[model samples]
Target: MAKQERAVRTRKALITAAAEVFSREGYRTASLTVISRLAGVSSGALHFHFPTKSALALAVEEAAADRLRVIVERCEKFEQPEGPIRLVVDASYQVVEQLAADPVLRAGFELGGHTVEMGSSGRVCDLWQRWVASVLEHAQGAGGLRSEVVPGHVAGLVVAVTAGLEELGRRDPRWLAHPTLTTFWRLVLPQVAPAGTSVPLQFAGS
Candidate 1:
C-alpha cells in the first residue's frame, strides 16, 4: 500500500512539473532534465515514471482530456433541451477559463505535442462530440432546433467554434472572462436551440 501511494505521489509530482515546464517552454522544447528539476526528482527517477517525452506528453493530454470530459458530463444534469446548448457554451468558456487557471491545461496547449491521438486523444474528442451531438439531436426531436440542420453538422460547428474560441482565449486570456463570451454564446445558441426556446445568460450573472 505504501509503495502504491508513493508511486501515485511521484507520478503527480512529475505531471505537475511537466505541466510547468511544458507551459513555459512548449512541448518540443521542454526537456526531461527541466521536468526532472521542476519535479524535484533525479533524471533517473523521472525516466522511471515516464520512459520518454512522448509518454509524458501523452499523460498530460490524457489529464486534460479527462478534465474536459468531467465538464461535459456535468451538462447532462440540465433538464431543459436548451440546457445542453447552454451547457456546451458554458463548458467551452469554462475550458478556456481553466486553461488560464490550470497550468496543466496551459502546458498541454503550449506543447503542441499534447494533441489527441487516434486511440487516446481522438477517442476523448469523439466522445465529447457525441455528447454534444446527442444534445443537439434531442433538441431537434423536440422541435427546439431547425430540422434542416443535422445534429452531426451542428456538433462539428460547435467543436470548430470552440477551437476558435480557445485560440482567441490563448491570444487574450481576458477573452474568456469578458462579457463578450456570453454574447458569443447567445449568438451561437440560436442556431441550435429549439424554436421559441429562450437562451439564458447564466455566465453573464457570473
Candidate 2:
C-alpha cells in the first residue's frame, strides 16, 4: 500500500510538471527531460510512468476530461424541465469561466491546440462532443428541444461552437468577457431551445 501510494504521488507530480512545461513551451517544444527535472524525478522514473510524450499528453487530457465530467454532472443536478436549455447554457459558460480561472486548464488548452493531432489532447474534442451530446439528449427527452433536430447533430454544433469560443478565449483572454459571454449565451440558447421559451441570461461577471 505504501509503495502504491508513493507511486501515485510521483505520477501526479510528473503530470503537474508536464502540464506546466507543455503549457509554457507547447507540446512540440516541451521535453521529457525538463518535465522530469521539474517533477524532481529521474528521467527513468518519468519514463516508467509515461513511456512517451504522447502518453503524458494523453494523461493530461484524460485528467482534464475527468474534472470536466465531474463539474457537468454536478450542474446537471440543477436541471429544470421548463428551462433546461437555459440551464445548460448557463452551465456551459460557468464551465468555461472555471477553466479560465484554472492554470491547469489553460495549460491543457494550449497543449491541446498545439498538439491536437499528435497527442491525447485531440481526444479532448471528442470528449467535449460526447458531453454535449449527452446534454442535448437530456434536453430532447424533456421536450426542451425540437424533435426535427437530431441530438447528435445539435451536440456536434454545440461542440464546434464551444471549441471555437475556447480557441478565441485562449488567444485573447478578454474575448469572452462579461457582456460578450452573456451575448453568446443569449444567442445560442434560443437556437437550441423550443420556440417561445424565454432563455434565461446570466453572466459569470454578476
TM-scores for candidates 1 onward, in order = 0.82, 0.80
For residues 38-70, what per-residue lDDT tens digits would candidate 2 score against the true structure?
999999999999998988887877676666777
Measured by TM-score, the strongest candidate is: 1
Where is model 1 more than 4 Å wrong at Cα?
Answer: 81-83, 107-126
Q: Where is model 2 poorest over a 10-residue stretch in terms of lDDT?
A: 114-123
Give stretches of model 2 more than 4 Å off. Answer: 81-83, 106-122, 147-150, 176-178
What is candidate 1's lDDT per residue for 102-147, written digit by digit as tens?
7776555544425544234433345556777887776677676766
For model 1, what is the alpha-carbon lDDT of residue 72? 66
lDDT of 1: 0.69
**lDDT over C-alpha atoms for residue 202 of model 1:** 63
